[model samples]
Target: MPNSLNPLLQTHFDTALEHPNGIKKLRELILTLAMQGKLVSQDPNDQLASELLKEIQVEKARLLAEGKIKKSEALPAVKEEEKPFVIPKGWEWVRLGEVGEMQTGTTPETKDQSNYGKFIPFIGPGDIKNYKIEYNENGLSEKGLEKARLIKANSIMIVCIGGSIGKVALNDRDVSCNQQINTVTPYNSIFYHYIFYSVDSPYFQKTILQNAGGSATPIINKLKLSKIPIPLPPPAEQKRIVEKIDELMALCDELERLKKSKETKRKDLHQSIITQMLEADSQESFQKYFQFLTTHFHELYSVKENVKELRKAILQLAVMGKLVEQDPSDQPASELLKEIQAEKARLVEEGKVKKSEALQPIKEEEKPFVIPKGWEWVRLGEVLQKFGAGSTPLGGKSVYTTDGIMFLRSQNVWNDGLYLDDVARISKSIHEKMKGTKVIGNDILLNITGASIGRSTIFPLNFEEANVSQHVAILRTFTPSIVTYLHKLIISDFFQNLVFKEQVGVSREGLSMTKLSKFPLPLPPLAEQKRIVEKVDEFLALCDELEERIGKAEEKRGEILKGMVNDTYSRNCI
Candidate 1:
């Protein structure tokens, strides 16, 4: 290898080894080189591929004379315009059918019990994975084999139908395949591996897709498959290329193993750091590990999963009252709870809200975590003036209109805020009937059903009024001053974790109104709540910056890998 080429290959491999997609691209590059005759140097002493072509022709003629294989129609001669590239001096470009017998198989009648008793392996496209077929899951009887195309072991099979079209694999043993597979038996067995690598090349796959066109079910017929051009190298050069490919592919496997091992260690260390901060015995110990994280923010946040963990940790700390210090100067959370209770009692007496039955006292064992001083544990229903999910309008989706009152579904709610892109709507009369489910500005919406049960969002003041469906619930705080803090609490991991644990039902699990009403909420002093929200917003802004930086860094790395491949291939092809 040239000294200049070594660095390009190394840089490409080093940059992408950490990601699965990157390793895939690296494999594509390997196959690209092998197909282009760039993986191994050509030797002048080796016989020319044109001479090998004559020998392949002789073998084909002998097979035809012996009546072992059916004679295929002579394909059109290769035109100069059809050649994709200029090959080395000892190489030749020939139509694939010129050197191989390509045939499609069939399935026998399934109703005949006698056709199912034999032990002949029956292969399909799904049976082939990676580069070789290890075993066939189905079998055929002697009667079935009479109607099936029997391909010899080591022949190449390419899927010719549906989504698996162009998927090629080497048959390790003799088998009968379905109509979706096209088997290619080369005239010379020495060229089997060479042709297998060629058919698996990126160029061949692209050509196959181009021929498949835009049909509902893409397929490749025998004629189209045979017309695919092959760049044949001298017999000796093909052997050298295969050997080099095997050695380098083995190296790639080792590199992939090492990358995954290193990633596992990094994840373990990252989790340990988070655990240490969350389980700290004192504030001093917590800050020590947190400082280490801030100093190495770029290194730790490069992985998206790590950033998600950071986000979760921030939310957990906020709900635990550890995000901000307790203020002895401010009134305690017990006083706030008492004031909310008095307000709720007044509303029930005035007929403004419904009177509800008393809630069960929280047991000590049910408390998930300890709260800081000046904090109190209360059921979520205590602070809310109203709490209930909505109901779907009569006729459900049939009542929806293109332009009318907005209809909010579970999909409309996200962690940060409401998403209106896929929202539905109803007329003014329908909105009137849904008065109980109507939402207003500052109202928090929670998805209480199905896959997105824990998602919560606050409706913005500037948006038009809307009514939610059965999947969403509206939570109206008795005191409007703490709405933002309440919204944050709903989004916090502490609340979400509890919601998941208390969900009910079997077929389609849901968070029932009773369960949600009894959810334990950690109440901090009003003044401290404000401080905690501000601190969380500031830290979240920093996390957003880290995410943007990581995205750009990955984009730049991808561009470098792409440029290296394009530049190296362009220069080498000349």
Candidate 2:
């Protein structure tokens, strides 16, 4: 409704103002402005878009005569009622088929891996990512290429169907694409980039999705694409808009790169400060390091991820006996180890638990950090009464029931804790058959495989007799106090990084039971362990609160930025 901007500009900017999705939305706004003939002023002397369209039609007819492409049927003129908004004086509205040739790419029925010979870039929807074509270096064999349509460099490719529909890319070299993509080649050089930008605009993208009629895999056929209208700007102004857009987009890219670089530096700084505190030789040194971090807490803890790393550092420091002052009067870890060994022996002798295989001695080179006076390094297997994998439900889907005993999968075990709310249920009969795999209160569950490998959680008291899927392993402590310390230690950065590095497998990576049982842990004095757990929990809770506040602050900042951009456009339009 604002008259200051040409109606087309006002409408484009207004729609952008309503939903500033993110940085991506900002880029789309610039493109829409460029395509709608609002980004740059047109000179009265410059040739009109109608003249350019005539030249394009002549080229297309010549190409058709040469049999380069088939002659397309005459398209219906764009109706006056279908026009969305008024364009600038030198621009005209035209159907996309009037400016370029629309054609589908080829689809191979089958691929032979052995026949893949030379390196030629094969592009699919996945390859056309973020407006750029990423070519897989390996090329298909002559037989594979037999089924594909080859596209030349500079041709515009758009994914017409599937999950990546509406994505567009400018091919940098000759390439072959899958059936999901449609390729468009401009008839002339007058506004090739401008036309590319027009079709890739958010408006056209939405239109494509809406017009794509299929239920399963919605597709925009060549016929539908031929009817899509686009605003054609004069040649001179098109160049100017393209230049301006390139400059602004470069700035956005720089901002993203700088943000990521700064985040990486902040993480490194946080790690350095944590290392200084953990490696402090004496109480005074520890006090100095701690004070330094506390003084710059605001500077270091501004981001939620930094705060999370700090929380992990806090746990690591606690288990290493560096988080709190050690008491000389408390029983030594050496004595505690003896008690744990005796308990394990007793359990094995009473036939209450099975004895584990002999664990390898901790090598001197394997010790990552120096322990305090009363602390000792011990293998994790020595402290546990039982450590073994869970059982898989029999008959798969048939054994699963809606109202029955609970079954905890590896997915349910998060680093924070166990999530029992969405657990799968199995019949009581199945639960009874796998009684050894049944989880009890205070049982520690650890994910042994897949992407979320090494995540652990303590089972809550609510689930008394729930069994676990095979992917999860149970670790029951010999002493209740050791459970807390061990859980903290396993979740610490030191152990997690070690686990990630040592994980093995070609196809799927995970922690092996043999490797897990041999992991070295710092055992502090019994009383000191209790003190460390309490301090870690207190600090972790504080981190959680800080993270929530940071999330809310980021959301508010994004909204404010969107508001500022919107206000500027609104004022310009008025």
Measured over all alpha carbons after superposition, the RMSD of each candidate to the real structure, in angstroms, is 2.4, 5.6
Tens-digit lDDT track for model 1 on 1-574?
Answer: 2253434466677667644467766767787778777778899999999999889889888998999888889888778777766677888888888878898978888888676644788888888777667574458888888878888977889998888888888887778888999989888998788888888877788788888854699988888989988889999999998887777778778777887887777677788888888777677888898888788776777777788888888878888876777778978999998889899899999999998888887778778888888998888888888799998999989999999999999998999877889999999999999899999888889999999998999888877979999999999988877788888888888898888878887544778888889988888989998998899888888778877877777787777666655665566553
Report lDDT per candidate: 0.83, 0.78
lDDT string for model 2 (167-285, tens) is: 89888777777778888878885566777888887668877988897889888887898788888887888888878777767755765566568778878888888888888888899
Clashing pairs in 1: none
State in Å the error of residue 8, model 1. 4.0
Model 1 deviation from native, Cα RMSD in Å: 2.4
Error of 1 at 475 (Å): 1.4
